[model samples]
Target: MERKLFLKNGLAALGLAAIAPLANACKKDTSGSDTTDTSGTTTTGGNSSTTCTVSPTETEGPFPTKTPGSLVRSNIVGDRTGVAFTIKIYIKNKNSSCAALSGALVDIWHCDKDGYYSEYGGTSMQTVDYTSNHFLRGRQVTDSNGLVTFTSIFPGWYTSRATHIHVHVYNSSGTSLLVTQIAFPEGSSSAVTLVNTTGSSYGYTKGMSGYTYNASDNVFSDDTAALETAVVSGSLSGGYTLTHTINVSA
Candidate 1:
């Protein structure tokens, strides 16, 4: 799609929720450091020769924020409730030896604590009608460090897929570069398990009984998860902070 068209459109309409045929309800990390495939990261001077691997693009389907440009802020929690979540994304330029890609447009959106999305809803995949709502969605421009952070709630799970976040990166010129998703950590000690386990207070109703694991997710099942997952830290009571690195060839 054209860059101008994408920005001008804003979240005016909601994409159809992918249900039934959805490969995975949801078929859907690491920490400070980038994936092993990337040689290294830039230093404080921002002049180091960091060669990051080009991350594979993923589908932006089911639901993508219609007008991301309209919602530009660090705190995207709009009337939604759940465990506080902080998302940090670092975008690097693989084509330019992995230098920090400053001024890049980084937009992210995810489901609420109850497996519902804003703007468009009421589909088989999503029963609630949130067509007029706009939560858990925002856009920001990467700073000198090629980083943009967003404040939201720890996303809840749906069927067929694992808990994940959708990210669309655009160049400084607003040209779409990569559209990918960030998977969360699993296991008993991981935040994903803790948040889902406690539903009464947090509003996370589904729990983990029928939850989908990353291994069986249709999107990340292709083995690209190594680079797609984020390194999450913190707690169920204290909230969680996620840091992920996205490498783009542009």
Candidate 2:
């Protein structure tokens, strides 16, 4: 895990100066109010902190398409019902002083509330047909501020794995830059717990039962803290928001 640096003509250095305007534009809120967390920290979206450490790369798992264009779009929820969840990812180039990487393709996919993935079926635990169902899978291109958003349901857990979301970043030409995963904080938050237990009427079925936590997940055990996302906000009934910054070597 040696830190890699970017040269003057490297990908990170390209269009580095154009990100500020994009970031500012994305922050323009009609309500003129910042998003406040339970800790009273107000932030624009969810990237208020300044940590430039590169996110550890993780396996893309066995589900992602080997090539692009399988199912590319911004909103991936696709008729699946569960706790409403929105994920915001900020992409930065660590080699370029963590400059925001504009126009990068951010791809994300995860299992539905019942621990079944879309576009694939007949796995050991997943007997339902999903070859035509593309829920919980989508891609968004980074804006000028290096931000991409995905509208998805709260990911459900399957056997031998923790609650997590898979992310892949690529340049505009589809050159893969980073492959990693974002994990939820161990133990359900006040918002998540309610959805798991009493939100069954709202399409929640995981309920944190027989679930594997981050500490035990092999891919995340090396450094779970770094891979975990900030505590989620809002309730399952009203939808939730989770955000994290991803630093990658360009």
Candidate 3:
């Protein structure tokens, strides 16, 4: 009889132990009910990253990337040949109508008189000693009055794009707020021929197509005519005068 009583008591103890684990599991579920899904998975907390989008007009103008070089280069006609030409860029916050934008940064790059651009990887652009950094390209910061100047050559015309300089403006924060290519007006036949010959040597497929206007450029369709002026005064042996005004919208 004692043996039977011991067996019955052991059975009851085993059953109670199993019941205890079940009760604990139920308690845990109830405590976290608010966080668990029907599939028993815990809900995610707010720990993910997100991206912010901003429109172009809301940003300010660019800050200077480099100090203005004190080198007083010439803006003369004689500088366009094997020599490098210099240009003074005027930065403005507003267009010709007079809007005020301060602290604009201007970045400029142009091809050399030989129709070669720096970083294009060719011997024709520079001299054998590589001293001719002929493609005059540089950046400047607009003062409180909005002006930046650079020393560059009279860019020879390319097949599709005419003789032009590319300018990119950004706000202080490095945001690209504006992009425009400045172009030169059509000159005498000799000037046109020079551009065509140099451009052909550089593998340009198309010849100059009657100096396209601002309305014709695919990228700068909305740019103002006054902003796209071409200043040409003379040749590398002589000198030339070309002035362009860029008007930016507020």
Candidate 4:
């Protein structure tokens, strides 16, 4: 009898642990009062550590999606070429005790594989003259489950900035809540090193010679790397998938 009880309890505990990360994705407090998700807290990078802290607010420039409201599609890969990357961003309401923030608007934009951004170029910032071109940028609204996904290409690095993706979140009323950027890990097995090192023939010609790392990046250098870093998976051949939960005070 004692052995059977132990097995049943262990299985139930495993089930709850699996749902912990999605549970802390966050929700909205319609009544204007503090609410908490009884689901659980976040599990960072497959670790046992759990917390529901608000995502750090960062700038959305050097470049931003010029007309994000008009680009409402899930797939933002418009003629760009490089390794495939899928972005899954979970928005949680810090004010609501880290419940999933349903129905929020999210805008994400990043540079192409060769260190180029569409819509604006040829000036001092971008010398490529892609002002008439638009790619690698799009917008999406969170589902009732507080999640938004985007189809894009694996981004390349540029001067002064490490590999990153810019994000802008808004309330249902279209009010801007936070502007931030997603950072990636740098290791032998990470895309940051592989995409630039062994991806030259694959069109990632920029290489990692003078690449900027997170430790030297201006925005994430202030110890915000841990808070903004995303958990990226997959490989050079099969493409990559990135998952990061952003908590907001909405």
By lDDT: ranked, best first: 1, 4, 2, 3
1 or 2, greater by TM-score: 1
Q: Where's the lowest-lDDT run of ten residues in candidate 3? A: 1-10
User: What is candidate 1's TM-score against the reference?
Assistant: 0.80
TM-scores for all candidates: the values are 0.80, 0.76, 0.48, 0.80
Lowest lDDT sum, 10 consecutive residues, model 1, at 1-10
lDDT of 1 by residue, 115-155 (tens): 77888766554577888988999999999999999999999
Full-model lDDT, candidate 3:
0.39
Better of 2 and 3 by TM-score: 2
Each candidate's number of clashing pairs is 18, 0, 21, 10
Put down candidate 4 lDDT per residue, 1-250, tens digits, no spaces. Answer: 0001111112321111110112212221121112112332112231110268877778666567888899998999998988888999999898988888999999999988877788877665566777887798989999987899999989986665668898999999999988888887666446676778788767987666556576666676677677788877677777778888888889
Best by lDDT: 1
Supply candidate 4's per-residue lDDT for 144: 81
How far residue 206's Cα lies from its native spot in candidate 1, in Å, is 1.8
Poorest lDDT segment (10 consecutive residues) of candidate 2: 19-28
Off by over 4 Å in 3: 1-84, 95-97, 122-135, 189-227, 234-238
Q: Measured by TM-score, how close is model 3 to the native structure?
A: 0.48
Off by over 4 Å in 1: 1-51
Look at candidate 4 and give me any clashing residue pairs: 25-92, 26-92, 26-98, 26-99, 26-100, 26-101, 27-99, 27-100, 27-101, 122-129
- Per-residue alpha-carbon lDDT of candidate 2 for residues 19-126, written as tens digits (9 for 90 to 100): 111211211112112344676332332222267777777777656744446667878888888877888888998888999999898888888777677777654334
Q: Name the lDDT value of residue 220 in candidate 2.
A: 56
Report, for every candidate in turn, its global Cα lDDT versus the true structure: 0.72, 0.64, 0.39, 0.71
